[model samples]
Target: MKHREYGVVQRVDHHGRTAIVNWYRTYTSTDEPVPQLLYESEMSVYDLKDHPDFQYRPGTVVIRVANFTGEDANCTAGQ
Candidate 1:
């Protein structure tokens, strides 16, 4: 499923050409009466424009709000 989410670039590794992205999610659950948000961080090798969640030009520090797959938003490191 697709959901609206946001990702912020937290750190970049020039040598590895990778960036650490902090992702945020806001959603309303059937069991909950109010909206809730979640936060997660991940590393990616794709450029900002090529990233699945970050397809726009990013500044030194960046934040992009876009539609993301449920798998992408719920993914956690180390399974």
Candidate 2:
């Protein structure tokens, strides 16, 4: 599986166990369009303090999306 690191947590849906994340627009690549939101079930969120990037705020968190190749990313969360 491949991993794609997303940006700061804009908002979280506690009921759905999901989150809305936003990427740093300045740093995005041209090869592919990065989604502005990702699900927590398909990703792992970590405090921005642990990230090496200086763009994000300290109190915010970043998400690393779980990419399962041809399969669904959300399928590997709890199982």
Candidate 3:
């Protein structure tokens, strides 16, 4: 997984859990791709496709997906 990348969901956990996610078709957005933190994890890999907000792992290729914007780049804790 690269930092601040845009790509499609390559795989998902069969156990219905968030495991290691891989992105193949990747792209880089000149503008920051914003994601609604509240709804970030709300959608699954299947839901990401055709979704206005292309959600995925940290820093995955999101392309033109419409998402929320925040000043905080690091969504993780203790950053």
Q: Please list the Cα RMSD from the true structure of every candidate, rounded to 1 decimal place.
A: 12.9, 14.6, 11.9
lDDT of 1 by residue, 1-79 (tens): 1365666677888888887876656565544333344565556557454446546555445433333345655654434
Off by over 4 Å in 1: 27-37, 50-79
TM-score of each: 0.39, 0.29, 0.21
Task: Pick the winner on lDDT between candidates 1 and 2.
Answer: 1
| Residue range 2-31, candidate 3, lDDT tens digits | 343434444558677443334332334636
> Candidates ranked by lDDT, best first?
1, 2, 3
Alpha carbon lDDT of each predicted model: 0.56, 0.49, 0.42
- TM-score, cand. 3: 0.21
- Point to the candidate with the largest TM-score: 1
Candidates 1 and 3 compared by lDDT, better number:
1
lDDT of 2 at 20: 61
Q: Model 3: how far is 67 from its true place, Å?
A: 30
What would the TM-score be for candidate 1 when compared with the true structure? 0.39
